[model samples]
Target: MSSNRKTLWQIFRAPLLLGLLSLTGLIGALVGDGLFDLISWATLGSALAVIAWYWAKPTV
Candidate 1:
């Protein structure tokens, strides 16, 4: 693969994985009688922060 493709993958990997994991956790929280509300909110907030950081400092 081209270096550009590799770079793109690297750039997106973390956020994508985090997002997926967060979604899974949110779903789990919704189904179970745990602290789903807090967990989901916190996870969403952190994910938004990550996205903002990436948007502010995007690498070529």
Candidate 2:
């Protein structure tokens, strides 16, 4: 196999993490107020930041 080929973990890791983070944010926002509200916003905002970073990145 070529060294350039990505492992399954490498391919799936980011997407899996983003999905879990997004789920946590949604649930947090739904289940409480005050501190939970802040936690949910931070979690969700980080996810959005990651997305924006990817969207604005320069392509090879």
Worst 10 residues of 1 by lDDT: 1-10
Question: How well is each residue in 1-60 modelled by candidate 1, as lDDT tens digits?
Answer: 255546678888987988886886678667766577667777767777877987999586
Off by over 4 Å in 2: 1-3
User: What are the lDDT scores of the predictions, listed in order?
Assistant: 0.75, 0.87
Assess the local accuracy of residue 35 in candidate 1 as a C-alpha lDDT between 0 and 100.
Answer: 76
**TM-scores across all candidates?**
0.49, 0.80
How close to the true structure is residue 52 of candidate 2, measured as C-alpha lDDT?
A: 94
Residue 15's lDDT in candidate 2: 86
For each of the candidates, give the backbone clash count: 0, 0
Candidate 2 Cα deviation (angstroms), residue 7: 1.4
Per-residue lDDT value at 29 in model 2 = 80
Clash pairs (backbone) in predicted model 2: none
